[model samples]
Target: MNKEARLSRLTRMALGRESSDYLSRDVDELTMVEELKNKYGLENVYRFDVGKNIDGFSPLIQDVLETPELLGLITGSLTEYPENSYQRLRRQLSLHHDIPPEWFVFGAGLESVIDHIARAVLDPGDHVLIPVPNFDVFQSVSFRMGASLTFMEMPGLCWDGNILESLCRKMKEKTYRLVWLSNPVNPTGQFIPQDDIHRLLSHASETRTLVVVDEAYGEYTDRPHAVRSASSLLKSYPNLMVLRTFSKVHCLPSARVGYMAASSERLRQATNTYRPMFPFSWFSLYMAQLAVLDGDYVNEIRRRNQERKKCFFNRIRQQDSGLETFMFLESDTNTLMFRHRDLGADALHGLLAERGFLTANLNRLTGIQNQGFLRMTLHGDAVNEKFLDACRWCGRHLFR
Candidate 1:
């Protein structure tokens, strides 16, 4: 009997949509470099191909990682569901956000949290609004729900009342079941302003739309001068759902830890339906618990990240010319997506590889259509200098 013939409609339907990219993946940097080199057949992929935040653990987190208690989590029994442990984690997160613990929902990462939220909110044939050129993981949420996704162009940092009125009119007409936004957007690395966010929340209130604000890169927005968190809106806007992750400044991408903040009732319901199959190990949870209250450490990271971003910008600019051509588009986040007129992202990726640096070609990403956008995860002065050197080399080759 043929396998296709043997399969039931239910089983076949369960496979849902297939991914265009991969059947398997690992988050390890070395493995990623190897995979990209093999698939693209490039040499010396010294830098990663995506926007990766620099991994820096403070002395507090470092000391905890070295202890026996942290070690115990890895060797411990996996079957025993640690409900109390998670409850404690939630409590700590709530205090950090200045909200009640019941408002939080933990997951493997923001990816799982967003997927579960989409499932919780959407039905078949529903509508979704997401900004263009976002993180690829968020699309999976809409994909699984069999929903229609509309990618909106971003209103830049100074979005005004006219745009807000136009947006509200659309929301009123379509009444989207869900509106997805990535604050300090991935790939672009700029923030949607607070006033603009408030207007969207107001619109969501009218439509009863589930507004998903993914703040995975939230910590990066906290500058040395001023700090802010969207979690502050939870009280007044019950429809607003926010996501935060350990992947960025927390330096726990492999740990796969993240959580969501919303009204207590919504999260309580979402917990039972969403399971983290690539679940957080006991080790990940334990480590998160240790650092949950380290607000000062998070601020220090923000200060350092700002310094690094400044260096990257300065190194790439035409200092004496002062015209600011070949600059990174405005960003408050750690990832920098710099634009070039002479080369498309795909061509630049190849040229950078030839010069022994690896950077992502943003041309192929679904919502991205325009060319010549090369993406890099901005790091400290030393690595930024190396990247600058490569850019200078590539420029000479490209022009001559």
Candidate 2:
């Protein structure tokens, strides 16, 4: 086949493929809830199924509803209040992270931002490096843009500096345009050190490649400074783009608010080329603004989350002798990744779902081979206890 024909075939394959249904659950909604109620008890049944912070609920909703000034700022028209509000937000975020306001582009969400970045920077067949066991959104967007994804398997339970050097070598081998990674990576919850991040960026800069860092869970980390904030890195590396979201940290996933910090030139190019779709709803923008400004609520959620994660770690250590357990990669995040040799995670996940517990199936996540590892999001004391009991029960019944 000719080159054009091969390109056409690849595009067809991409466009024809369905969006991933990993988020889909087939259990009866009512039955699932009832089972949750039964296992964890009606009052204590906590859903750690997603990355949302339960503590941010009341303050987030309350702030959005009570503040009308926050509601009126839509994309098209900018009155003084709305303009000032946006400027204020930009100023605060820029000051907090020590980046220029011009370096950031506010978008509908991180997924939208990724799509925009892909559109701006990638051509068909261009190579994009990504660590495996990632959020599917990265691969999905890259494929849609006709970019070839090069997978770099993360060193299990730790960040290996060698991986970054190897990735640099891979970049040198091709006209690879981008490197995408998640700090405190999803599923594994491993934190990449600042030095390693610097080496990656240095390599990318030398090769004229853009490094896209997704700090979606940076706020949850105990040592936030160890991982270079994308905003801060932008000053030195113009080729670096930092992606952040209100979804995980602020519990505003429904609000669909996210932003990218990069060099001013790159930010302008992305905004111009992609033309971000505006105003998911006046309500979404309002909620996002409220969430960002509500420092007390953010602090409270962080505090409770830290406490919950500590409690979970303690419980897991105590129970790990009999059951398979995954530990956080020496980071201050609430997610844990572990492997079980005897019971395949798919079978175990199914069994847990039947018993009213839901967790991320690690095997299906990255399509990487694993011995039944699963990722669990820690919610709070009650939820942590339930997960512990569920795992203990599963270990005894399923593994035995």
Query: lDDT for every model?
Result: 0.70, 0.69
TM-score of every model versus the real structure: 0.85, 0.82
Q: Candidate 1, after superposition: displacement of residue 301 in Å?
A: 1.5
Clashes of each: 1, 1
The Cα error of candidate 2 at residue 367, in Å, is 6.2
lDDT, candidate 1, equals 0.70
Error of 2 at 293 (Å): 2.6
Tell me, by lDDT, which candidate is best. 1
Predicted candidate 2 versus true structure: per-residue lDDT over 1-400, tens digit per residue: 6665656655777768655424654557567677677765544434556666666554656754666664454434353233212565577677667777767687777888888888788878898988776777888778888888888776654458777777888988987888888887765677777778888888888899888888888777523333246566677998888888888868778877788887858455665467434535555655665666656665666677777777666766674444454333334566676555567878777656655667766666664555576666776687667676766677677535
User: Candidate 1 on 251-367: residue-level lDDT in tens?
Assistant: 777777888888758554765367654467766777687766566777887787778867666655646522233657767777777765676666667777766677766665655
Tell how far residue 18 is off in model 1, in angstroms. Answer: 7.9
Q: Deviation in angstroms for 306 in model 2?
A: 2.7
**Residue 90, model 2, lDDT:** 74
Give the number of the best model, judged by TM-score: 1
